[model samples]
Target: MKTVGLALAVTLLATVHVVAGDTRFERSLRNLDPSARLEQICDYTAMLRIRASTPFRPDRAVGSASSPAKAASNMLVANGAAFRSRKKWYRLSYTCKTTPDRMKVLAFDYKTGPEIPEEKWNTYGLWR
Candidate 1:
């Protein structure tokens, strides 16, 4: 009976931790900058990790059809999802970039396969 009680307590603790983490993620999304510029948007550098849910595909057609700059601009306007590591929970940041030519939004994963070195992510729009 004692062992069972102990196990139950551990399970409850784990569940609480998971719920708290999720809450933090939601809060982060709410805190994202709604008016950040494309250049200043992806300028995040830290031991942080981000998780994006939306599909991310390079706008090759746009790049070929227009100029490289224009294609990059279109990519940033697409909608997507993103997750970042924070003190207590992962912060979620969503981006939606709209310009006269195009609009896009997306979620991004900063802590993907390999650690992306701290560098300037110069582009013309927002990323999730």
Candidate 2:
């Protein structure tokens, strides 16, 4: 009985950790209004762009599909890419699967404010 209880406890803990790790992205989106627009800015091919905007806010972030996990917290701005907005800025991470023309932006996250930098971004797949 003791072993069974311990095993069950461990299983529950692991499940919670996985669920928690996945929630950041969902939480970020939850703050947006239903009308917010999520756009596919660029096609795949190691480079891709996605934009999400809300009338209440005008900030956004764009990153490659292979962009690292730390991208979530750091707010990294890709080289040669311009981040535009007068309001707060957001972070967007993506995963490309094919050529630039055939590729597609997979996932991303958004928040208000400038990027934190490569080091500060969370390594978790919050935007994956």
Candidate 3:
């Protein structure tokens, strides 16, 4: 019975992995020119927020984003799922730049909502 249970668990895990294939957002992030480096910068929760949100096209961004000079060159953008926590709607924006060396995060901006305003994110953005 123990062996059977273990096998079933493994099979379920594998099935989950296969079912959750790379999403478009996942693919874009993975295929970054210089490859993004996010481990040291972001914690598990932050990463989770970004991963939970995907296919961050401009239209779905909810707010306007203006790239800052500080955001390295060749920037790529993606947004995470929008969620409501404690009566507040929140969203995550992952912006990174691919330099000749490696992709580095320019900003991970968390925008607050009820009514998200359209503004230059790099200039007036909040970071987590």
Candidate closest to the true structure, highest TM-score: 1
lDDT of 3: 0.39
Best candidate, lDDT-wise? Answer: 3
- Residues 19-123 of candidate 3 have per-residue lDDT tens digits of 574343445455643323332222222444444674322222322223222223444343433332333334545444433343333445543233233342234
lDDT of 1 by residue, 29-124 (tens): 445553333322332211222322323221111111111221254234212222223212221222324442321234432322221122311131
Off by over 4 Å in 2: 30-128
Could you tell me the TM-score of candidate 2? 0.26
| Alpha-carbon deviation at 21 in model 1, angstroms | 2.2
TM-score of each model, in listed order:
0.30, 0.26, 0.27
- Model 2, 81-123: lDDT tens digits are 2233343234433332222222223443333334434443334
Ranking by lDDT: 3, 2, 1
Local distance difference test, each candidate: 0.32, 0.36, 0.39
By TM-score, rank the candidates, best first. 1, 3, 2
